[model samples]
Target chain A: MARKILRGIPVSAGISIGKAYFVNRQKERRIPRETIPHHLVAIETQRLRNAVEEVRQGFMDARARVPEELKEHGAIIDSHLMICQDPKLVESAAKNIEERAITAEWALERSINAIGKAFSAIDDPYIRERMQDVRVVGDKIMQALIGTPKPVDLPAGRRVLMAHDLTPADAIELELSKIMSFATAEGGKTSHTGILARSLQIPAIVGVEDLEDSIRDGDLVIIDALKGLIFIDPSEDELAHYGDRKYQFEDYQKAIVKQCHLPAETVDGYRLEVCANIELAEELVQVKDNGGEGVGLYRTEYAFFNKSNMPDEEKLYEEYATLAEQLAPQKVILRTLDVGADKLLDEQAMLDEANPALGLRGIRFCLRYQNVFRMQLRAMLRASVHGNVAIMFPMISGLKELRQARFVLNSVKSELDAEGVAYNPDIPVGIMIELPSAVMIADTLAREVDFFSIGTNDLIQYSLGIDRTNKHVSYLYQPLHPAIVRSIKFVIDAAHKEGIEASVCGEVASDPYCVPILMGMRVDGISIAPQAIPGIKRVIRQIDMEECIELLGDVLTHATVSRINTKVRKRIFKRFPEELSFFASLIEQDDITEP
Target chain B: MEPSGENNSLEVVVCVENELGLHARPAGKVAQLAQSFQADIALCVADQRADAKSILDILSLAAPQGTEICIKASGCDASEALEQIGQLFHDKFEGDT
Candidate 1:
């Protein structure tokens, strides 16, 4: 048994075992508060000034060393530099030292406390958060004054980095090459630490509870970021187990990357189109690098959000045109704007519905605002001339809404025709079969569109009558439930009956255990995030369609989710033991919670 | 905001045009440029005032994009300070969106 086990949200995927080295442990230090002699007041003031100068020089050096790719982090360093030298901070501390004749450490602490008090009074949460930056700068000065500055410089070797909360300045100043992996006590899924770790291709876990308290500076720790687990001072058996696991993970990574560009075909000669679902046009490079056949679902909401005003039609056209041109000849299915619910526009916020998920969103929101919808349809039509561009509409409930969307598209096409604008008149039109109503009547909807994309994430949510984000009922989110399996199969059959192709583009498609079942259903294609492509394609290549079909047949007989999960888990895990260890599966999550 | 009749005192109303508003990067730029001149500069968002030379003071204002800010300065180079500082806002701090 290990001495301790800590769990966190894993941002990057890998396995690493190394000595832990904490750059900034959040353990509160006991300050020696002493009243200085009148004679030594000038000396204490000088000491304070010297520390400030040293820290400022450190910031400048870090700024100079900012890598070309990480230039964004440089601006954050400049903010720290200004905060370090600000009179509101430094001058106040100096004033405290002179007037009270106290030690520099106590004076600085008092100043930070005063600033914190002032900051807490401010109502703006963004500004209130700036107090953390003030504390980070203050901590640096405190370390300098205490004469044990910069434990950041590691001796000589790679180690797992631990921190209470890593600031941008600390990340910039640290020698990144020597760090093997990282575990931070603070930060959520989208934290800076996660972004840095991912860019460096190192394993990392954030929001790790008791990370600083459980592990010391030199303790041997294993970071199983694949499952977001940390084992400290593990037993010999555990270490050996992890040692083999790490070696296998690395070997698997190399193997999959080398074979990624090859077709996602089963051993028995079953072929599946594997595409990438991306939001930004910039991710095309990633798609190509990961061996994606094409862009399966291009979420068109990003350009519409995060700005003060709506994007003009011209800007939208250029963005789509560039994307289509870059991925020329390969299909790019652009999903029309699906906003509201979790992501709301300025105008939508005024409505303020109690249950947004069941309210105006997706096609409903687009149909209500015809101008915005028409503008997007015009851009999509205009961009279709550049490459194999197809337009998809999200959250369609029935035939009427689909027709309304197509009506708007036809009107835009006629307008472009009148203006003598060039576009592809035969641009493929598709709809995401996510809503339960759409799945039931998919046969009718399929006859109207060119293709079908199964959005399993939303389908499972709406079908199960559970919001997966809600903790209380999230346990009910069974991706491999008999109902979900039947729903997916029914939609695929419906699409096939109408001579249309059906693809799965959701978390379900990315799972190693779930992909086999999807393949068994004869899904025409599967669209997933770029990073998941390699491993998923590897799984597809290793398996046979005959066995997957057999597993599906066995799953069909099971009445409960637990039974279906058990049957699938045993069969899939036995077949692909190596792949199962690395990839986090939707089916595997059920084992821990279910009886 | 109007400039006073005194040659030394000048004021300009500039809108926060950056997408993320007057966050760290823009606030740092404002404070750094403010330090170069000998002007007594203050930024006012409605009734609150912040010393223009201090990044902390500038950040504490928490002005989002489209918020109107009055840049007040009084010194020998007050007009020049207002002009340069106002230009930074118009340029969106000359960095990322």
Candidate 2:
């Protein structure tokens, strides 16, 4: 039979073959709502109480079942339990049952909706977020009342998830090993689900309309996210063809994994340190297996953001210590809590700034809460004793902010010293050159810091004044923008002149096209997704530094993003055609949509 | 009949300091702390009131950062309850600014 190929935006890149698991949220088993007879209202109210208690117990059990590394998120479950235990919430739901002679499910929904209405009526964004909590609690209670299990029943083996849409939390809660990839019927390239998929390096195709209608559970399919095609019941020839491609891809990944053990060097013999940016310590194996020299950017905010209550000193230390001990002599650069944009904060704190990406975030936020900043600094200092550790601050725009952060670090160091806590006295501190102000003042700022990690993603965003998250403007959020390249080169040159190391970590680090441009610009190191380590390293190994520099010089003079974008792709396609698919991931969406 | 003991009321206006303004973590902290008090605690933002003891309720108040919320506590431990809550806001719910 001829292969039937469906297309969508390839939000994440890879290829996978599996039986489909079609999940439509609107079609799920929900507790049916029927009004109870007035006499049976008492029983309905009692049922509501029992269900709440039972679901709260379920949350506790689920918390205990979460892996130890993710135990920090237990506090979130605890808060969920608190919602269940809230008398005001329970009494309101019970009141619905008693007064309206309604079923428990209907009463609970009514109660939660009433709360949601009140929340929405308020102008506060923080209070509006509470609507989701009520919805979550309502979901749990509904599950209890209906005697249903947790959503998304995973098969014993690998299966592709075909959902109408999936939230970031739901995606995180999924069994990553059992799911091959995601084929969602809605969402665009910058969806929260898309971001999560890319971070997890899962192959996903989003915005495939009528996907549920076209395919059912147990249907065999091949998801070619690289080409944004799903081969439905592929022909034997097509299956064999995709089968070969799959092995080649797996073989390529294995080669990349092996490259981790090899020293990352350019053909001209310049050694470049390829580091892995990780969220959890458990990813250390990938860092090691992928030949990462050390942890370049440890997002420490996961510990703080995942919990209801901020983790205490000891809890933060345990994670830091584990990371230090595991990586040992190789340095771990922990970016202290970049938590303003996209990072969950309380509603009250979220006000004042209409635009989050440009608002009071990153270093601006940390400096405001000096105590919390000091605690993190103290923990890093305490952990440095176990291994080589450094501190890097994100979204720093000025020398004053850098000095203020340094002051907090100094205060913490003095506290540790007075307490006689043995910590490395010479832990290096660096600043991420993510803002245009940081780039313009790189020389002055470079004199004060140990290194600069040009966070190209944010640098691109802030430089172009494009909201990378907004789909309408995302097309303009290009890494190949002349201003972006020059800004990065400027930062690297400033860092080099100051006798400090410079690196690039962000979407640019993983992009095959950006790697050449960055290496050519003479960045000392690159930290990227663990899986992308080998592909980037392999590309670096193939090129001489002089050739890359020459190529960069050619593109830097180009006046437009498209001119630079066209020239770079032409250079890669002309020189290294075998790796065409590597650049395709970043460029694919624009091609199919544009002329 | 509510079990809030010893009728007394205490009220204070406090600004939310934490960034992300009264989002989940701070709201959860507010709910957690409110549960420990014997008084009935209610938080009002923009004249919209939410039961302080409920995460869902406090979250519903949706006061942005810098929002001056009025925390009202009634019954036996009202003063103590208000003081602790006011302190949390002063400390920015112990969340980074």
Candidate 3:
């Protein structure tokens, strides 16, 4: 009989069935603080140096293997190289070895902590995030010193990689064609390993504890990343079933890839617009390939975060213009730098924010410094001339902030007009209905803006008083809560009442359970990660508007979140049994790790 | 302020005006400049001090925007070293004016 399926948090989406290849990194954990004999110190130090060279050489090899299009990621490899070659790290390791008589792995840990102590007093969240980068560097070096094999070079056969944990540096340089998927016992969905797997379209599952103990080498593993489940040693019937399903999935995916160029309408002829939310310009190709009709959310802060110098209007214009021209006729909603909180800025006001989520951030931060805001507005305006573009403001609490933003946008527009810049003078302006206050007064605010796009992530956070970054309170950040559905209903109803479109650009928009409910809500559009386009569209095309509306009605009538959640899941899964089954692992995943 | 003549050293304090503060990339630049000068250089944030030329040490300072850091140097190039590091902050470590 097949062993009971192991459930884990799904980090990336896909399906793979292959022989298991286990990579044990347990030694790094087992001897975190080991002591060395005094005489062995020299040998340990030499070992550390050799490990550094080996890791450094690995980076050099990885860099050489990286394709030209992915050269932007070469900067990450370079950062790792800098950490490996850093003299302080090397010297500190040597010092710890000679003085404390510790193992190289133990020495590296102590050295990292000793360095981390200096950053303890610093208040900048952005700088604080760098502490993790240092930790990653330390771990990478230790992995090298331990001579852990990455299994990067897999033979041309179906293979499933099982690791205790995998880093970006280990995963990025592989010739990924041979490897079918990845399952790890550790890492979050947004970890570099998970993100890289998604970008490469590789099937990946993380947080699968004790995978090495149960799953042996050469075991046939079925990785259903969509549902975040991996089936081990399946029966012959299951294999045959999966074999047919895999074939259909690939053919369906290929068909959907071609459908990007087609209109995102339902089989019943219900035309619902689907767009892409992009972090960088390189993703434009992915967006296009995924059949995105337009750019929904252009995260401008990424451009600001990556550079040392303040991103001037010209630089912003060039970047925005490139995106606009590429997706001409398709609208690009450029959100002005939504910095603060996790994202840091060079400005004092942003730094001074004690609670960035509720402080001088988003639209509030923009209004604080109109000159900086003006430059961004000017750049956005300039880019609009190149193609169809729209402006959206983040974290709009009330009409006052929205009006204030429009006033500044108008001023920038006037300045452009005087300068004889040709732009879409009547470019559509929108507001992200993310705040609870905005949801309450959506009727009032909807009358003022061109459109309303619901940002469910922050909306839920503020509504439930959940600090998503705080893991303890994260369970409270429920997307299917009765409150969220009602809020979404309010905003969409208000937008419809005002004769404007309402769109969902949050994580929930792409969720299978949320999709039918959103479609039932009669949302004009949904914007999601490019990779999710096909799967979501497949769900959208399968259901009728009447059933969706009925499902929404059933869900909203319930008082508790769990009640509504169960109802929505049952209704949607009934319509998409195969599709939801594909993503079933994540559904069975007891609790969402995301805040 | 003029250089202190005590042991031919110089001590000066300057606030980081850069919006991103002195992060890793800019810290790298500062560390490189510190290595070029022939002086006993150190940067102090509050009571903590980091060897000016070590990138890891400088980054550990975690000097956010508007953090006033103290630089102390004693050598023939004390004043010169202080001025250059101070100027990097003043210019926001933005390569071009």
Best by DockQ: 1
Query: Model 1 lDDT vs. the true structure?
Result: 0.85
Residue-pair clashes, model 2: 22
Which pairs clash in model 3?
A227-A583, A227-A585, A227-A586, A260-A291, A345-B19, A346-B19, A346-B20, A347-B19
* Candidate 1 local Cα displacement, residue A287, angstroms: 1.3
lDDT of each: 0.85, 0.80, 0.78
The residue-by-residue lDDT of candidate 1 on A1-595, one tens digit each, is: 8898888767577999998877654533434355688889889989999999999999999999999999989978888999999988998999999999888987998899898998898777877898999998999998889876553556589989887776433565678789888998876543445544654568888778888668776789999888778999988988998899889889988888888999999999999999998877767887888899999999888788735589999999999999899988889999999885556776678788888888889999999999999999999999999999999999999999999999999999999999999999999999999999999999999999999999987899899998754434655778988889999999999999999999999778988889999988899999987877998999999999998888888888889988888888888889888778776566664332200
Q: Per-residue CA lDDT of candidate 2, range A1-595, in tens?
A: 4345677767776889888885555636434445567989888888999999888888889988988899778877877888888876799999889888888877887788787777778776645665676788888788788676566567688889888777665676678778889888877655556656766777898877668668756778988877777878878887787788878777767766675577878888988999988887877887777778898999887787556788888999999999999998898999987877666556316575777777768988788777778888888899999999999999999999999999888888888889889998888999999999999999999999999998887888788887765545667768887788889899899999999999998778877877888888888999887767777788888888898888898997889877787888788767667665533445435675310
Most accurate candidate by lDDT: 1
Q: TM-score for every candidate vs. truth? A: 0.62, 0.67, 0.61
- Individual DockQ of the candidates? 0.44, 0.37, 0.29
Q: Which numbered prediction scores highest in TM-score against the true structure? A: 2
> Which scores greater on TM-score, model 2 or model 3?
2
**Can you write out model 3's per-residue Cα lDDT over A1-595, one digit (the tens) per residue?**
3574776657677778888875555542333345667889889999999888887898889888888999878866765666666767878888988999888877887788877776666677777777776777777788777565544545567678887877654564455676789998876543446655765677898877678667866778887776666788987876786778778777767866765566766777888999987767888988888878788888888667556678888898999999999899888998887875555577844367667778888998899989889999999988888998999999999989999999999998899889898878888999999889999999999889999999887888889997654434544657878888899998999999999999999878878888878888899999987887877887777777888888888887899877776777776767778766555322334543210
- In model 3, the runs with Cα more than 4 Å from the true position are A1-8, A15-224, A227-252, A258-260, A348-353, A584-588, A591-595, B1-97
Candidates 1 and 3, the one with greater DockQ: 1
Docking model 2 quality class: acceptable
